[model samples]
Target: MADSPLPDKLDNARVLIYSHDTFGLGHLRRCRTLAHALVEQYKGLSVLILTGSPIIGRFDFKARVDFVRIPGVIKLHNGEYTSLGLHIDLQHTLKLRESIILHTAEAFEPDLFLVDKEPLGLKGEVESTLKLLKQKGVATVLGIRDVLDAPHLLRPEWESKGAGAALQEYYNEVWVYGDRSMGNPLEGLGLPAQIEQMTHYTGYLQREVPESVPSKHLLGVPQNYLLITPGGGGDGVEMVDWALRAYELDSSSLPHGLFVLGPFMALAEQQAFRERISRIENASLVTFDNRMESLIDNAAAVVAMGGYNTFCEILSFNKPALLIPRTRPREEQLIRAEKASDLGLVSLLDPRKGIDATEMHRALQALLKQSPPRELVADCFLNGLDKVCQRALALMPRS
Candidate 1:
């Protein structure tokens, strides 16, 4: 048997990313984007992601990067969790996930460790690994989205989950993937001074336009179309339905509409959407698009749920967008959308405020017909990956 390469013998910088993605594609996608950006900026870097997203394998990874899929845990809409497609008990599944995470960190011995979103991870699953990393003197950073939630909810949740303590004791830094002038992800909860000082606003991770994408003509779409995307589509039925309803009123509101119904949308709901899509002469629907950035680049405008990743894309492309943000479970999206609107970056349509097809159509018409004054948001933050790569390089040991 061959001996494993010793730590000093390894020539590449290793970064281990933990994305406890209980649901949706947001966290995994962000981590993967950061990973790719890091590899690009810092040559001879190897990346490994520990992810629990069920669809982790569906997306392709770049060279010198891969993932170990942790046992899946599903978080229901009502804030409950269960083993995703696993016959084992939830506790066992979590234990198995924890074991794999800790084992991977130990074996990988990465130069830096990045934890996405949750500070202690889902139900504190990554606590042991965090502790071990701390003892090993591994540089640790917790990467948080632009919006966490309403401060009241975040305070209680962090307190009960010991997230604040974990942040202070284990991690060396916390990077918010947003600009501070936009909104603080930690605004509501009064974090201790030390921990607060540790947080750095890295700005938004701007997605790069793909080198090549199918042309609008080749994709069988008109020259101009409003791109309607509900992100992962798990909680996107309302947005998709509303867009279709808007089209029913006036197809001219948007000359053409291309809807990317995420794969997580329920089959029955998608079928219902397909029925509606059939009725709208100028609207198109695709169940999924692995490279959504390409579609974003080609689209004339955007209408979306205003998730963090989607907002980043809209900012990157400077797309005139109508954001219909959900205000349930967490008000992160709602708050972000409102803030972005105030900054003249995007417009918002709060779904809960008695909005209907007419309202959606009005928003759509405004977005598609009128290009937003891009100059207002000309200074918006979009170079997060660059800043993050710099910080990581500074923090990395002399490997």
Candidate 2:
């Protein structure tokens, strides 16, 4: 990475990231990735991530990157959110979150405020914080993923949350972490001309193999395996079931499979997978691993839900991948999978068409021998981190 131009002033610059983190590990993980990258690029830059993920403590942070844990909220299957642990009602919980966020911004006094995905934040919890930060002259940015839900679903949802108004009033810029070749995530949102002008496409964020690698003995990593992950595994039961069934149906044709069931996956689901994996000679299960990049780096191929972070890693590592994107709650993954598949970056097996075990088996086998992504796309696709750093430098005020 290029060195920051204003290193002397960078020591005093700080970036605060807000990750709503209501459902899966996606928000927290993406924030962590950006935090790490920013600190690495700018030598004394401090990145503080404010998150509501219950398992935020599980992952490691770099020297200049840290996190402040707010009260947790969990999104239900029915699209409602409830406090993850507190017995307080949703209203009380949201108030508590709002207060915490506002106080953190006041205390931290960040040079830049980056909000992940949610424009107004979870139930508008970050609205007060955004307003306060704006008055304090903090450069506010909205970092959205490559694809949000379908336009129809996202438009109504954003309208209900007053996202458009929030963007127009508070945020200084909107950063789309994707390439235009893939698709425009905000295609039909109908933002005003000014907001559209503020938008910048930073391509896809690229991941690297971590500097430190844990011993295989410590992680119990199997040899020459295929990595099958469903992101946080909150809604991954069906994907796991299909993969296991594929193995049970025919294991002789496939390589050893390492399943990383995420921490948020239910206890019952983990136990069931454990029992099933024990019976299958070619399959093994791990509940969760913070060092996921290392595992993906060593894997022969990958099968995953095609979430943003995982997709970046697959492209970064140049692994042949088979994506089975979920269509419920949001079509983000499905949209991503379709676009990447069309570009020949990854193969897609749409669940909307019904995922048959036989088809899954065939896909996995094909994936193991398929060409890696690097052969197809230019190197510019993974240049998101560098572009983001450039934007950050431009946004920060010089001393």
Q: For model 2, how many clashes?
A: 0
State the lDDT of candidate 2 residue by residue for 1-399, as single tens digits.
434453433777899999989988999888998998888878789999999999999988999898899999998888898999899999999999999999989999999999999898998888889888888888999999989989999998888888888999998899999888988888898878888889999988988766675535235656678889998999888888888889999998888889899988999999999999999897888888887888888899999999999999999888999999899888999999999999999998988889888988888889887999989887677788888988999999877
Q: Which model scores highest in lDDT?
A: 2
Local accuracy of candidate 1 as per-residue lDDT tens digits, 143-165: 99989899987899888888888
Q: What shift in Å separates residue 224 of candidate 2 from its native position after superposition?
A: 2.3
| Whole-model Cα lDDT of every candidate shown, in order | 0.84, 0.88
Worst 10 residues of 2 by lDDT: 1-10
